[model samples]
Target: MFYDKVFFLGKILLHLSIIYFMIASNKIIYDRNNYSDKELISLYKKLVKPRLIEEKMLILLRQGKISKWFSGIGQEAIAVGVCNALSTDEYILPMHRNLGIFTSRNIPLHKLFAQWQGKKSGFTNGRDRSFHFGSQEFKIIGMISHLGPQLGVANGIALGNLLKNNNQVTTVFSGDGATSEGDFHEALNVAAVWNLPVLFCVENNGYGLSTPSSEQFKCKNIADKGVGYGMESYIIDGNNILEVHSKVLEIAQSVRVNPRPVLIEFKTFRMRGHEEASGNKYVPHNILELWALKDPIENYQNFLRKENILSEELEVLIKEEIVHEINEHLRIAFAEEEISSTTENEIAGVYKHIHFIEKKPNQNTTEARLVDAISNGLDKSLEVFDNLIVMGQDIAEYGGVFKVTEGFLKKYGKDRIRNTPICESSIIEAAYGLSINGFKSVVELQFSDFITSGFNPVINLLAKSFYRWNQPADIVLRMPCGAGVGAGPFHSQTNEAWFTKTPGLKVVYPAFPYDAKGLLATSIEDENPVLFFEHKALYRSIYQEIPEDYYTIPLGKAKLLNEGMDLTIIAYGLAVHWVLDEFKKHQFSADIIDLRTLQPLDVATIYKSVKKTGKVLIVQEDTLFGGIASDISALISENCFEYLDAPIKRIGSIETPIPFAKNLENLYLQNDMIIKEVNILLKY
Candidate 1:
């Protein structure tokens, strides 16, 4: 009993420290006469509009009028206050609950309702879920379902805007649950390091869905988490409109000038369930009753009455006007047509292609290796395109692992030749941010294997941005891939299959110095996000005299290396060189087709070759199973069946991960394996 008393007392002390040791949690910035009657009334209208919309949405959700809704019933003040503070030019990345952001930004009410209804007129053309659409016109970056990733995107926006010399701030929102995510921490650290102009707000609504703060975090407040990153933080009464408005407005104005990040923890609660359909039985009735009495709408109304700025009659008229507006918009949205089910219409704009001025193919008579060729391409691209920005780890001073960007720092300066932290995801997403804001960015991954660290932003956000909202991710991700030279499994991987399966991304795999130079140039110019794969083994192995001047090769087009009718050999990257080497040893009359781009697959060239040869062989440095070889093999067997005289063959590395030891690595990826398979196909 004595031990229990001591533990309880310690717990009480910890709780007291959490509340009081915080960076001034209970600061009152909102004065009684903070605004004149006109200003007060405007603030109240902005605060109440979302409440009326959410209340009506709950009714629609229950009656099955809408498919889903994540009601922000009690937390209207933060969205309104922050958005009110930001100018129309500054961007805001709001979460699912921040409906007031749209209303306050003056987004078309009918279109928002149409988006909720999944109509064609919606912002995302009904491709995205409700409240997950952006409007570039309004400077609103729509929130994704994975809430934490948006913080990194916000960093990208701020980063891009900073480069543009635009004095604009980007504000992003997340909940307490998202604070536990790595993105939140990484984004904050990046913002602090770069001194980016981003206002990070965490609406500490006491819960994330049904999970309480106790389960979500151990920190005193979400704002306290920001203090760890050396960012200024404040916790204010999120329920009070005056406090949220005044505090957020002041911070935003300050952030716009000073150019740094700030974290605000708005103290509020979820009065309703997470959504209308989800029950809230787990919440204690006492806690629910307490939050209900501190309702944001009710408290703000009382604050209005206390100041004598709004009478009961004026309040009723304001509410009636809001309801009428919502109803009038819903009437138009309800009559709007749903998204079309046609095949062509559905797939249109799912992938985008950008036009570029095709540079004349010129041979400047420069002897270069594959790595040198890549550097030449990037050099020429930077020289030609003023909007081009390059970022990677050690690429600035160290000039990258392969020295591809050697002397680039001296050539381009610090802004263009950026060395980034090991945070891959944040940089990739920031590239996306740059692309959307009228800049083209090229991001170099340290290795193809490390792409997993930044996979979410690539696949989920950049891959889907254009499809969802016509947001162009005009960025190139230079991925050094493949096995050999004892780099081992972790650094050596030919991972093109992972992205070829995913739409909205272009895959470029070039063999030899000439193709490498040309394809890198084109990949940078292409509007879509491109995965430019350069084989590590071939970086300096082969040499050729190629064009030093700028050139552009179209993506998805294959080059015929050596043509013959006896057999066809299909390959890309290092595999293409292996075939050429085998040809040097023995004169095998076969059509060697180098697939420069993998995603587009150049099926016409492939099918034509297979038809002429009537027997084909596909080779890759990657493992056999679930690779692009299997897909191409199937395509040939299905379409070129009648033309084939023998079974279509394929050769790839051993299934196990690339080994560390030289002998085991040889067994893992053997070029002689190609010889044995090629012989079998020719003999058959």
Candidate 2:
């Protein structure tokens, strides 16, 4: 009984000691007086100057000199605070409204003005507007207008930095409205799971456009959402420039040491409208007045002056310097010449040297199926390019769901043939990160329908990388497409049309084994990102003449499988095979044109074939309304108007959701019977 009493007293003493240590740590964390007045003033100044610049720019925008502007008026503290804390080696992914932050980072004032004026001398060579600027020299990954997408990109960039074992952090900026997007949730989750060194800055300015934050989210603080993902979070006064800067430096340092993500909620305001032209009357007056009281510049200037760290003379000198700099930049920007005709044509300069290589006769060619071709292509690519990496779910040890990437791990080792988590966003993000860091990545989406989960990374970031940053992302996204495998609606889908509508992405669909091997090789070798869609139905379907050795077929060119004067059948992927079988069975001498690439479409071959046949039938596996058939019909109708003998015919899936029933699914998808409609049209 005496020993038990002694043990209880010892436990009580230990608990008391732990409480004392926690109290001391809390004291240290909350002690603002520990900071020197000079440090506080300097931080305040860094935040105030950017706000002033943003305000002046908005004024210029109102005067019609600036065509477009995304205001960063009240959110100045967040930008300046975070950027000032980051090192030069670190990267930044800014959104449209974060121009003030870029300016603070030393982006040339003349270049910024020139971009706004749409002059050729702009940093992007007038390709992008003022808001979408990037600089490799500044270590800025660039700006994207899409909401919530940059977070995943930041995760990817941070992951890359971690892989290189570099102590650099990647910061991504977004509005409170962006948190509602699916990509935001996915990105935060992945970043937490991977422990990536990134900081997600949520500039919660009370409203997302006209919608108030109170209505959109249930959480009291945006930072509170981080708890759900097991992440560190902080809520700070965005108007308190000194507080913001100090917290940012502390958090960034913590991330560097611990290598984990953090969410910062900057409780700021949008002083101006969303854009310069917006009236902002939709925002309630009471809320506006409340936010006005917390203006970052006003609060910081007052704080600086009160501390005696800044004087009236210094303030006047800084204002004069800023005004003079703005005026000088405006003068140079206005004097710059507009884009001439030569310069307009130069916009297409990237593809000037791009030539289509003709298919050469293969002495050691052997007949194979689409699946074999895919495997052979992977083998050849690995043999040729040392940097090529193949990754996907169940791809490493299990050889993937369709075994398309079989034996890749055995040949390339674990690092190159990586197996990713089931999360689709993580897979795509990893590929994007690897591609940017000089790895030729071939990422596989388990099925075409699942690509929806990774849509933002594909369309917003990968597709725009070249056009936005002038940086080539040699990434290949391979997916098993089409709907005849009894995989049901959720698993079976042809989503090629979805990506084709997005500019800057090259979509390739190879029908035959020969074309599959050749086109896959070409896509792997190309500097730009490519989306390769492999048809599940055609994977096992054998073709007559596939080469045993490796080769490549150029993109943006069509293959004339057969020659006929009666009619022309334009098809791609599985549809091409269906049309071929139908023509053979009906004994119709129809010309068959296979569209190998969708974006840089082979208009020359298509127009030539349609003109000769004087009739066109466009067939695809997607829905009839917005399918590639519509694009083909429009092209032929516009370019070969005089040559057409009858109205163009289109064959595609019925405009309805795919049914789970086999018979209904068969009827919804195109079959050889659709070719009978072409014969009926020829009779006209």
Candidate 3:
């Protein structure tokens, strides 16, 4: 009985010890009197510099020396506080108004001013302005004009850190207004699903552009939404730099090891309008006066005075030094020459020369259908590269709409082979994030026609990413396209021409099973972004012997199926088959050129054929207007005008959507249409 009493007492003591330790570890590390004086002074300087720089930039804007400025006049505390929490090597994806983050990172003041002036000394070398550029060396991601997409991108970066086993947490900033964008929820959901090491900081300045938070969200605090995604959420006084710093730092210390996302909503206000051009007319005067009373810099200065670390003379001296520093930087930035129109800096200058992959002899061959070949190609690529990942709707287990990814989930697991929500724009934006972090993503768009839903990321972000920042986005978008199976207009459309005209994109379309397998291999291995189109009709219909050993077909090179001198037929995708069928029946002595890749068109082969034949006929599956056929016809008229004996002729689907009726669908871009166009070229 005495031993039992001793054991009970020992157990009670152990429980008490654990509770004491827990309380000690989480004890508040700083208070009004206990905070370090040196650190407080440093934070004060960080808070002051951004305020002065913003005021100077406004002055320059009035002088017509800078184009525009987005002032973070009232929100300096959040920027400095969050940046102070991060380690030097940790990544930061910040918004334009977060100037304190830049100053804290030692981003030179001259370069910042030069960027605003559109000068050569800027980060983008006059290619962009106003926080649209990021430094790979500094671990910062350049911001796109669209704000919310960065949240999804931050998920990718944090996932990368997790994969690398690097115990580093990433912080991304967004305004309260951006939380309304779909990308915000999409990113938070993904990060929470994966349990990533990231902190999403929302500067809830009560207004987004001109809209107030009352209209922006139905909830009271943006932090309230974090719990829905299973993340820890908090609301803090943003005007108090000490409070913001303490909370972020404490959370950062925990998340780097435990590795789950946290959302901290900094309750602040935007002192200035959206830009200098927007002069605070939309904001209420009384609201501005209320926030001015809580100014972050003024509050910090008052705190410093209470601590006896700041004096009136000292404050004046510090301001004078910063003013002189700003003037010197501005003078140097202005003296820097503007970027000239050189070959390297011109439009389309971002595209590097195509390094074509070499062809190899086919060996260990196996006969396969077009779909099987494409599936095999993707399988081999995933097996070969650890960095390669694939994502799409119903791709994880359903194996995709056409079963192209049938067994990927079981083989690769859900991490690499992912199933995403029906948010098409976020899918591509996530891919861009993955690509920038040294991972290659092969994103599948279930149907080519659905690209309209994801067009903004393709045109605005993906197509322009390389040109703006010269970063390699190694992504391949697989689009199953074309008509002939009577799936109707929406599902059966051919949209290759839409991307072919878009710069910074490589478009590839193959006809046979062998070409499909080989070209997919090439696209996966290539460094640049490629839009790969596979015709649905050819998936099961076309069959051929494909090499078991991997080999890549060179991009921007054409295959001459048959050579002749009477006429030259130019075609690609499914149209190539129609031309081949018509030629065999008519017994025409024409050179048939199959353009396997469309972007960097194989002009040499086409020109050589046209020069010998002296007549041309272009065929396409897309509509007659704004299609590749029109571009090729114009090229022939300009380059081979003398070689051509007759005016260049082309044929395509009548400018109308494909109909659901069998007879009407058959009348569109069928073999008979090519035969009719071929007879005209033969007669000429």
Top candidate on TM-score is 1
Q: Which one wins by TM-score: 2 or 3? A: 3
Q: How would you encode candidate 1's per-residue C-alpha lDDT over 501-612 as one tens digit per residue?
A: 8888889999889888988999888888999999988998989988868898888889999999889999999889888899889888999999999987899999999899
Q: Score every model by TM-score.
A: 0.94, 0.84, 0.92
Which residue pairs come into collision in candidate 3?
none
TM-score of 2: 0.84
Among the numbered candidates, top lDDT falls to: 1
TM-score of 1: 0.94
Model 1 gets an lDDT of: 0.86
Taking the tens digit of each residue's C-alpha lDDT, what string does model 3 give over 571-595? 9988898888877787889899999
Sorting all predicted structures by lDDT, with the top scorer first, yields 1, 3, 2
List model 2 lDDT by residue over 551-631, tens digit each: 888898899989988999888988887888888778787889999788779999999888888988888888899888898
